[model samples]
Target: MAEPQIKDQRGWAPVDTGYLDNPKMLDVLDASGTAALMHLASVLYCAQHLTDGHIAPGIARRKVGGTKDDDRLLIDAGMWHEPGHDCPTCEQPEPNKVYVHDFLQHNRTAAKAKRASERASKAAKERWERQRAEQDTPTDATRMPDALHPAMLGDDSSNAEREKERKREGGGSRRTPSRPLPESWTPSPSHIEKCSKERIDLDHEAEKFRNNALAKDMRYANWDRAFTNWLSRDWVKRTSAGLDPMKDW
Candidate 1:
């Protein structure tokens, strides 16, 4: 059977369901008697350290507090195999070491775990780079239009002509500059018709509008629009209330 591939081994260790019911495990449990826990502790220690089921003598004695008698019991029960034994599953056996039977078959080796970690890191880095590149690349909607590009303007004359065309089309970002109220400013015919329908005194409102603009030193890009807005909003209400429109200003 092919071994399962492990991409990351940080969290868990594999244990078979029939582990306690196995004949080899039964023999170790029965032979070790009161010392069975120590022998089992050695197995857990190897698993936690990702030793591929191999237990060093020093680790068994000092780390797991297991004596040579415990190792002998596991080895004799066929639960563990001594070094130099002809085991087909052992990858690189060291001298005087004992390996757990079928450890590699059930769990990840240290080498495999290291490789999985490196692969995960490399994949994460590649994903980050791809996302950053996508963000840095400009899409069509965000790119500047070729017609408005400064490099496409060619010269001063062409630029001025483009500006005039844009203003005529009323489709550019720039707005008309404002100036102080004109000395000859007057309400247009449309303004007169609107005021007449609304029963507003057009000439009186017009004179008041001019006086207020001059008194406040106001400026506007479109004086006609400003006067129309002022008439629509306040002139009718003030005249109905019998309040002088020029009193507030």
Candidate 2:
């Protein structure tokens, strides 16, 4: 019947609303001729420690700061049971312990509290395991495609051959293919307006551009851009002196 020791003193213990109005409390109060604070303190100490109502003699004296006379008073008031008393709730009685009378009637036993703590710990562990499993599982979106799986697995020779084939077919190069200027090509309307604004003869410039490209066998990806470049760098305005504009270039 020795009081159990507890490390976790976290939760509240129940106290009846009419505790002070009880006959036993009234008797203890009358007998003590004082507040009877020690009796209430002992009851709380047993509850908080999950001691099953058992109070050690050393705890009553040293921890609770109760005198022998206080213990005697509570015992006389039927609020405490002395050591060596037969307890129906306990399988065997300890010789060096005192118990708060009817303590289990109002509070949880040590075994029950321990079981609840264990169950809570088990549930928390299971929840954490489930969360870990969910995080480790891969989704379909993140899974590698079957077509690219071999490439990812370091099939370097096949990958290199495919890259070379792509280059050979002009599929891998970023540049546009070059071609000779077309015989029927004409200046776009915007370029025609630009030449008119600058007083450059569009027909004359067009004839010279086509002749120059054909003469040199020059090739370009964008013929319009090539024409624009030719206009900017080579075209000359007709002079009033009657000299050929091409001769001024």
Candidate 3:
């Protein structure tokens, strides 16, 4: 089973206490071996995924800031091992560039620890992105595009309903203007004939009335209404009462 990693948010590292109890630790009393062991142990602890140190000989030696004599002492004390290579002079193992051994026993990063740390970093990054997206979004009341009507997201039926309502209010699309007729107007001979044949006015008087109504200068939706109104008001007043349609032919 994989060991669980510690939940340390402030970034702490792990150190096993078994090294203090090892009998070999007491045997390595020399200055070179002791320093080399400490340096190798620190490198292994910080290497992240490689719980076992697989550092290069030159890099490890340089990072440890130790001498050739110190590196050699580490091998003699069994504190470090070289994989896939041999020492030339002594025919013993020598440190290779690719892999170093015993880092697992001396490091902070186990498989479980690395997994936990990665998970934490990923979760933090996701949260930050979510917040940034939300902050960048606009929340104004009237910033919508012209084409985006309420019917699009709501219901398709509403579009038909709104069109019907518009027609009802406006009496449908107007083929002709509905502007009101003027109170006083002049009537053409054709207009006079259309309204009533009984009432009689001289051609000159009719023309005078037309010119006067034109002077009034009001617009009318139905010219028929204007002509009819003029006949009722002015034509009646001008015509002789004996020529009334009710009593006289």
Candidate 4:
């Protein structure tokens, strides 16, 4: 039996309905599910075929912020190729595949290492600068002023002036104001030596006290007792204030 055939306006027979008869130009499409290989070939062919036409390959969006040639290099290295696809940059008519990791992995790794090194370098520089500044500064004792010591400068004039003022204020003017005898006054070297000896004795006592475990233990025990007492008193005050009763919980 002869099968009936259908024809189009151009006088070409209609495409076969069977799956085997209907052959697509490309065996595998892109991940976009579009038959990109055939389209790509067609685009390239049309570009080559026409002497003057808009056969330019579709341009990719340019990376704006500090665009690295590395990502573009990876693209050229065939990292993002579909099945039977060519490199867009090189126009290499070879099958190449593009992996997402290949482009990002190296860049991220380099960036992390660079960041760590920079942070470490910055920290070290800051520490060095601080130590240098400290070393350049004067010691605390040398920086302190001698004017702070009242004994170094003679300040007896102020007392003498006050005494004069007191004598003038009194209604009865005494012919002669009685004063203490200078013969009774004497600088005692023994007294000064004794005071120095006592100071040295106190320092030694402090050193001995620090060395003694019983003294340290007693100090800690006193502190703990005081803290516990304070805590108990505070708890009583807070309880009396109705803090616990007023709490939401």
Candidate No. with top lDDT: 2
TM-score of model number 1: 0.43
**Candidate 2 — worst ten consecutive residues by lDDT sum?**
144-153
lDDT of 1 by residue, 1-249 (tens): 222343345635666687677787777767665335555555666666666776665565664566778777776776678876776866544575678777778777778777877898899999999999999998766654432322233456444544553454345643876577899889999898988787778887788778766655565667787677667755345673576444431
- The 0-to-1 C-alpha lDDT of every candidate, in the order given, reads 0.66, 0.67, 0.49, 0.33
Clashes of 3: 1
The numbered model that scores best in TM-score is 2
The residue-by-residue lDDT of candidate 3 on 28-127, one tens digit each, is: 5445554545544445434643434544445555555666665666556565555544533222233443333344444455476668778988999999
Sort the candidates on TM-score, descending order.
Answer: 2, 1, 3, 4
Listed per candidate, the RMSD to the true structure in angstroms reads 19.0, 23.5, 23.0, 27.0
Alpha carbon lDDT at 239, candidate 4:
39
Give the range of the ten consecutive residues with the poorest summed lDDT in model 4: 51-60
Ranking by lDDT: 2, 1, 3, 4
Query: Which regions of candidate 4 are displaced past 4 Å?
Result: 1-60, 63-115, 118-122, 125-129, 132-136, 139-148, 153-249
Residue pairs with clashing backbones, model 4 = 79-98, 79-99, 80-98, 81-98
- Steric clash count of candidate 4: 4
**What's the true lDDT of residue 108 in model 3?**
52
* Overall local distance difference test of candidate 1: 0.66
* Residue lDDT tens for model 4, 1-249: 221232112221122245222223222222222333323332323223321111212221121221234334323434333334443432222223222212222222334444655787799999999999998887757654321321122336324323443354343354444332222322235433442643323233223323332222222212222222322333223433445422311
